[model samples]
Target: MSGGVDSAVAAARAVEAGHEVVGVHLALSRMPGTLRTGSRGCCTVEDSMDAQRAANIMGIPYYVWDFSERFKLDVVDDFIAEYAAGRTPNPCMRCNEKIKFAALLEKAMALGFDAVCTGHYASILTDVDGNKQLHRAAAWAKDQSYVLGVLTADQINHSMFPLGATPTKAEVRKEAAERGFSVANKPDSYDICFIPDGDTKGWLGERVAPVTGDILDREGNTLGQHDGAVAFTVGQRKGLSIGTPAADGKPRFVLEVRPISNTVVVGPKEALAIKEIAGNKYTWAGLAPEHPEVEFACHVQIRAHADPVPAVAQVVSTTAVTGIDGTVELRIIPAEPLNGVAPGQTAVVYVGTRVLGQCTIDRTVSAVPVSTPEMIASASPVPVNA
Candidate 1:
């Protein structure tokens, strides 16, 4: 439980259902004794206390598990590394994969619990053949199946989402108020939990050493200088120091981010169009799709808020593959154009709300004029660092 209204109501519902419930809150970090209490987000000292209080109110046992070291190494460090390599990382997915389902489930099993339950909006159901499947939450707007798509069949088999049937955020708050939970009126967290101010560039700069680099136009002309290449992402138009006006007098878009040379490439809006995307680190929920031969069609989601686009998916072998880290790539051709597909982000595939699989974007295929060859070549090779 994160001491939120949903989790508090979930604990109450579990107890009302007569199932033995034990609330476990993983302590992801602790302040350095310098930061004050009630600081903005969860995993803080006060948040843990709120969880404990809710558990007590629900008349169940509660405890705080220290997983700070693992969280930092697995989630935080990986997030920083991905950005430094000029790719966007999904920390929520990482947290679910490494901490919530993996670590917390293992610890719960060791404690002799039959299953672990949470307040997530998604649901898990069993088919006639005894195979487990994930389903969408009743609340359409608050559905989080995209982030939770990385979960495997085994994890879903032992998980319970009590609030999956709850349709709206308003209803959740009402339930919590009826149950006498104090956090019903608490505001929901809107940004990344760790970085309270939502300053990704500032947070990354402080976490890792910054390197100076050049900002170049599509014609290979130096537009300006950037503090670090990792500070920008593809399709971003703000905070760019390129004061040079485009030939057409229109705005420019970030075409690429180069980590090795520490440079950012800018171009006209038309240069940002991509027809195909190749992804690595592919993870299917159950069966693995055959490579290079069998192609399937599904809805592919490139970003969290973007609408799912119809696409055909094909499995391809990596150009450079060895026995140790051999990778499988999934190629997606969107049925229509997508505006800002970024490399190093996840491409989550779904059949309705049933998560088919997910993969990390390794490359984007775009056609450019021969005159801009120098600019494209100078922008770092595709999937060089990811």
Candidate 2:
């Protein structure tokens, strides 16, 4: 249980179903606060106590697992690494992929548990052949399948979401109250839990060792300077502090952050439109497409709450030589252009409400043409099948 209404209610339902339920609260931080400051952070000492009280009410076993070291290595370190590489990453995605499903599930199975159930707003469906598939929850507004897109076929088989069929979060909260859960009215946590203060830029600045960098425009002309290229992300319009106005008298947005060059690129907002996105690292949620080599119609979602876009996607081989087979890549082309798409963002593919698969964006193709030869050579579109 997460010391929240949803998880407490989920545990209650699991117990009512006549199965032996055990409430496990993960200690993600090595050093956690005795009490949470409102709903700003989670996984603290108070959260564990709340979870234990709920478990007692349900008459189930409760245990606090110390996954602090593993969490630091997987989620926290990965966040730092991604930012250092100038790529925006979702830490929640990593937590679900590595901690909940991988480490926790692995230990559960070893301890004779059938599955690892959670309060995630997603569902698991079994096909005719008994193959498991991941689907969005009935509550569209509370759907969290995008974050669970990292789950593979094996992981989905051993996962359960009791709160999936609920029509709304209010229902979960009501159920928790009826079950005498102390956290029934407890507020939900938000933002990056690890960053208690919620100041991401300041948190990263300490570890990344911010270096002074140049801010350039499309023509490679210096517009201004930044304290650190790592602090900026694609499509960011604030804090540029550029004194010189654009020639067209329009606002400029961050087009790219080149960490290797310690440079930030700014351009007109229109230039942020991206036509194509491709990624080398990808995994199927359940089953691979019948003809992955050919383009297939689907919807692609980059953010947790963002609406999925109509798109066509395909998987193509990247053979190094004539007869030598190499890695493959998942290429997606949206029917309409996507604005501010960037590398390292996870793009989840969906066929209606069912999650097909997901890929980490490695590169993107700009819809606007390059202004100069130097620009074209630097940001040219790479063939997906090459």
Candidate 3:
């Protein structure tokens, strides 16, 4: 249990359904200024107490399991590494994959639990063929189907999301209160729980030493100095100290972040408009769809908060490269131009509310250059002294 009202209510629902229930809280790590004490978030000493309180209210047992090392290796390390490679990573997805379902679920099964349950706002149903399928929750706004889409069929069969049919967050809280749980008024947690302050860059900088680099324009002209190439991301407008203004006096946008050369490329706002994105490491909720020669229409979401945009997806084959591992790429062309489509972010494909699949964006392809070839040929190359 996550020590939240939702999970508490979920446990109550299971009890109301006449199922034997036991609460398990993962002890991720110790918080500062607390001796074996839990914080308000999951895995903290405080959270364990909260879970125990909920369990007691339902007359059930609760225990805390330490999974700090696994959390660091699986979730935290990958988060930092993805950012270092100029890609935005989703830690929630990793946590759901490694911690919640894989690690905790296994432990729960070993302890004699028939199935694991959580407060996730998604549902799992068996089709006519007895195959499990994940569906969106009744609370559309709070539905977490996107992150939970990474679950395998095996994991889905053994998991339960009791809040899947719940109408709203308020309803869960009301249930918790009516059941006499103490955590009914507790606020819902947001962002990465481990990084309590939500300073992703700060947390990454402390773990991985960022390398200082040069900021350059499209024509390879040295514009300014950046603290580190990893610090800048595509479409970032702040912190760039480019003195010169654009031809129309508009602010410059980060077009690319090159980790190989440790360079941040800046250009006009128009350069940020990308028509297509190529991605790798494809993960689908079910069987991979047939790779059609023509682009297949689908809804693509480049970022978590981004509204799913209508797009056509096609499979692109790639030759063996030196370090790149994937042999095939997923190409997505949005119905209209999209801005700030950064590499390293996920492109989650959806058929209505059901997530079809997801892949990591490798690069964005812009249209033809606005500047003339003769004008670019006349400019001298600016050297970036490493």
Which candidate number maximizes lDDT?
Answer: 2
lDDT of 1 by residue, 208-239 (tens): 78788899886668999988887888889988
* Residue pairs with backbone overlap in model 2: none
Model 3, poorest ten-residue lDDT window? Answer: 377-386
Instruction: Give the per-residue lDDT digits (tens) of candidate 2, residues 1-386.
Output: 87888888888888988888999999999764657888988888998999999999988999999999999999999999988888888899999999999999999999999999999999998889888999999988999999999999899999989999999998888888888888989999998999988999999999999899899998889989999888898999999998999998999999888877888888999988988887767888998888888999999999998889999999876453112356677889999998888788899999999999998787777788776742211122233432
**Tens-place lDDT digits, model 3, residues 313-357:** 877654432133336667788998788777766788777766767
Q: Residue 64 error for model 3, in Å?
A: 0.7
Higher-ranked by lDDT: 1 or 3: 1
Please give the distance, in angstroms, between residue 180's alpha carbon in candidate 3 and its true position after superposition: 1.1
Better of 2 and 3 by lDDT: 2
Could you tell which candidate, 1 or 3, scores higher by TM-score? 1
